[model samples]
Target: METVRAAERALMARLPEGTLMQRAAAGLAAACADFLGRVYGSRVVLLVGSGDNGGDALYAGARLRRRGAGVTAVLLSPDRAHEGGLAALRRAGGAVIGPERALGAIERADLVVDGVVGIGGKGGLRPDAARLASAAERARAAIVAVDLPSGVDADTGEVSGAAVRADLTVTFGAYKPGLLIDPGREYAGTVRLVGIGLELPPDPVLQALQHEDVARLLPRPGAESDKYRRGVLGVAAGSARYPGAAVLAVSGALRGGAGAVRYVGPAGDAVIARFPETLVSDQGPDHAGRVQAWVVGPGAGDDAATVAKVLGADVPVLLDADGLRLADRDLVRGRTAPTLMTPHAGEAAALLGVRREEVEAARLTSVRELAATYRATVLLKGSTTLVADPGGGPVRVNSTGTGWLATAGSGDVLSGLAGSLLASHLSALDAGSVAAYLHGLAGRLASRGAPIAALDITEHLPDAWRDVVRD
Candidate 1:
């Protein structure tokens, strides 16, 4: 990030040369020691690059050598190696090996430290560095990355080519946006933060929801609260071909904060059969009577008319699946009430007219771009669900959810849950984020280790909500 680099430059100027590097090396060595268990007689290999990243690994290698471990530094660029670091490693009994010897040393190593690139590096690993990365993967050695992982874009979380898969990353000062997002987040494995006392700005590039944060935002009905006062949610979903979508959506809404659920769709029989509490109607969303908020799309198939009718309402609207495809862009941008869009990578790519891979590679950028273009709250669902407000403040990344959540009808459940929260009068931003956190939690609880249906996720919503609100 430009701001982060500027701050780093300012801080480095004030501090003595090599002081920050020394602090970083100390923390790195301590982490390596813990991983090694017994430092004495342990074989450690360092993949050294050309910058301060390589210097940090060399210095940490020297520390390990002093404690009786056999340390070997594999120089990717012998001509560009850090002179001082090389001298210190030699003095501390560390050996410098060539790229030809890196594979053999790595195979026998107890631990391997990746100092091939720092946060400022772009694209992916180079040819020589990529060779070592491949060897590291094939070896039994536990890989530890210095700063951010090699080849990951620190600011954007994009990975285009070959990159190191770190078993554990020791990041100094602060977390890069890449570490928290997908693609890069997957390559990063597990992360350990080693603070070196650099003062960062108060507002971070991303924010994650905690249980306490979720508890504070949940709506609770007062003693005098009636169904109207508590909140009413209108759901326009499902059809003859996908009546289950309407059933699942209403299932989610009933367990949500909304006091009443109004179903206006062709799946009225299915909805009333499953949930007799719902007020079913044959008319469209325009004739569904008054509702605090409306959920559109999700298995409505090609029913653009129902999507259009719901979009015309004055109430807060949440658009998902088919609704995201069928809505007029200009009308969405011109709405008076708050609007929320939930799209997976494919739908998002369609909206932006880009490839799905492009959207997945640059999730943070895509989410923000969508929010700015639509001028509304956008929830980008994937490995990490991110909610971006129109203003581009810190995006909320949902920490919950499992890979098992990538099932059918999941988006439908999310739509109903978020729309209910909107009906409860939360700002679009809070409603989307809070619902995402709970929905993910429910998925995790439902699946645990096995596969779960979309309806199962909706069934667990009450448990998830109580888990958040419980003292």
Candidate 2:
């Protein structure tokens, strides 16, 4: 996983006057050069602010000017600009203009570089700044943000105020959380990281998934495997009120490479009807025979009796949906077997005793905190799904899936697949993230254009697995 850090201690160790800024500018200019087809006569606009962020943009503008591109800097605050960078830009034939002149130049520019704020700014764009950002957003020109979209909080992926929506964002040194999450992520568009001579340690925050990591972690069947020997997943989900969740969960389990799926809930009849291969047992968890893992929650509702029965199982358990609601953090902490949690933003907030917005803002942090607090592996679902282990390791973000996955019961399928993988002996963290990766891909495949049913998402799991396992 690639992570963005608050500060790179190694970079701080050697304070060479302008090395960082120079590297940042060179990277920015190179990236921008791709967007500017013919710089000799093309117009480029730079949205300048007060800090080192503006210095980076100004210096890049100087480089662009040398390449014969017509560069114009829109100084948000002329009194507080980076003096050295401004001088360099001026010497290289780059023109600086206030907000009034900026509006005209921005309208006609081919490219816009937002250097308004770096990682240090707070609470979005100010009133005047917001106007400029808003205006730039409406422009037809391609927009690129320096470091990040001006108003986004780098540490937490939160947008507290108005922010510039960019076509691309070139980050320095490492990726900040903002570039990988929603709200802020939406504004950031596509992110490209530029290593600026900063050797960062392992990030406390995590984002994005790489193929090699996923391939190493995903479970594969070995020789001498049988139905029971492989592992059986006991699903205790759904209620009479909502039996579709049971069918969906069963669908996911059936395709999850499990030995067999034992349905042990009120909705067993529904599951058996949909998937005749599933062992139908009207009995509770205690009487449902043996299984390697239990998947609880989904549409179980507020029934305490059903939840208790599922909780009594001896196998490793994956809890989601209603299971998250009835979950006692203390009980989860006491479990001997591994426990994995799959919660969306709202459910996570409920589990962590915080607001939904808070969980969404610091998704990586929230998932890790929940893992530690409950002593379980946690999967926080959203655009960038985060998976973290209580013991501590890199938290992985699932880069797959689209907004269309917000359909109903999609999470139920995720829980069942994750539980099945866990039953097959993968570690809780690996199981959760691998299942998520497959689930997200399944959703995208199932919903090529329109929204797909939750059961449809489950049906596509095998196809997704093939895509991942294949070259």
User: Which candidate has the top score in lDDT?
Assistant: 1
RMSD of each: 1.8, 2.7
Per the 3 Å backbone cut-off, how many clashing residue pairs does candidate 2 have? Answer: 1
**RMSD of candidate 2 to true structure, Å:** 2.7
Clashing pairs in 1: none
Worst 10 residues of 1 by lDDT: 1-10
Cα lDDT, all candidates: 0.91, 0.84
Candidate 2 structure quality by residue, lDDT tens digits, 1-471 = 233332544565577777778889999999899877677888999999999899999999999999999999999889999998999999999998998777889889889999999888889798878888887878888999999999888866778889999998999887877787776888998888898866667555664665566666666667987899889999988998989888888888888878898988888777877899999888688888889999988898876676666666667899989888987667788888888888999999988889998898777678889999999889999877888889887777788887788888888888889888988888888888888888888888998988788878887888888787773
Off by over 4 Å in 2: 1-17, 353-355, 391-393
- Pairs of residues at least 3 apart in sequence or in different chains that clash in candidate 2: 4-175
| Cα displacement (Å) at residue 370, model 2 | 3.3
